[model samples]
Target: MFEIERRLYDEGHRFVACIDEVGRGCLFGDVVACAIILPQRYTIDGVRDSKKLSPSKREKLNGYILHDSIAVGLGRITPAVIDRVNIKEATRLAMKQALDNLTDKDGKRIIPSYVLIDAERIQTDIPQLGVIDGDNIVHGISAASIVAKVFRDSLCISWDKAYSGYDIAGNKGYGTAKHIQALLEIGPAELHRKSFISKIMEGKK
Candidate 1:
């Protein structure tokens, strides 16, 4: 996992921001992105893809990652915006927002020397590389994935209470059978992605 960071460090990039997003495939809520800069050559045991870890494990790692990171930033794109621009474009915007929001522990802005994103490039003047499967292969990107996943999952709890009956907490906004059934019965809440659920709504009629 450290290979990419080590290589980049050798190439003189000190602050390499690794970025990833969670909830892109969800049928509800905002898409959340994270950009994190770990100290050069930093390694944390048990850090891997967020999808591969249990919720408890991800939460545990999230605390450690946040404590150790030089800088952390988060971005969220609402369902309405996702419907307006499409998921692909919304995801890019979220990632860029994360980068633009990067700040150190003291809340001062930190500009990365380079950016390593997972599977997508954005419009940024900063030198960047989009690595396929970076969350599993890159240390910093994996840390960012854990942070984004944990953050979005926390939001699910609040959404479950606010929206009710959709099982948002259990499904974490994914399009599960129960969640879909609820959508058909009670209808979508304001947070549900209209563009993503149109077909599901049509099926009910």
Candidate 2:
């Protein structure tokens, strides 16, 4: 997964921040994005896409990545903002925020020379490449995915306390059979994406 990043590094891209998002498909909660730049030649064994790892494995990798990364930043757009702007734009906004957060107090720190995104492009002056399924093929993007997934999942788990019975922790706000059934029975929670829920309700009616 490091091949493309290594090549880009060899080509003089000094700091390559790999970016990825999670919870875009969730029926509730926020869409989260993470930007991460690993030190050159730094890697952990068994680092893979967040989807391919167990929850425990992802949690472990998330900590390792945080501890080892040169710079790391996270962004999230809530369900309300997501409904107003739509998922695509909300995702882009989140990604941009993630990139913007990769700065210091004076805004002169940890900026990337290049950005490798996962299947999406953002409006940034920084040179960026949108790689299809980048989280699976690029080590940096894979690390970003792991971090984002863990962060978003923790949010869902916390939200479960307030919005119980939907199994937000287990389903992580996805439209699982149990989640959809809960929606039908209890109506949408505040965290539920109204745009997505309205369409499903319309279909059922």
Which model scores highest in lDDT?
1
| Candidate 1 global lDDT | 0.95
Q: What is the C-alpha RMSD of each candidate to the true structure, in Å?
A: 0.6, 1.9
How would you encode candidate 1's per-residue C-alpha lDDT over 1-205 as one tens digit per residue? 6788899899998899999999999999999999999988888899999999999999899999999999999999999999999999999999999999999999999999899999999999999999999998999999999999999999999999999999999999999999999999999999999999999999888
Off by over 4 Å in 1: none
- At residue 102, give the lDDT of candidate 2: 78
The lDDT of each candidate is 0.95, 0.91
Candidate 2 at residue 9, lDDT?
83
Query: By TM-score, who's the top model here?
Result: 1
The clash count for each model shown is 0, 0
Model 2, span 106-192: residue lDDT tens: 445588999999999999999999999899999999999999999998998899999998999999999999999988887888889
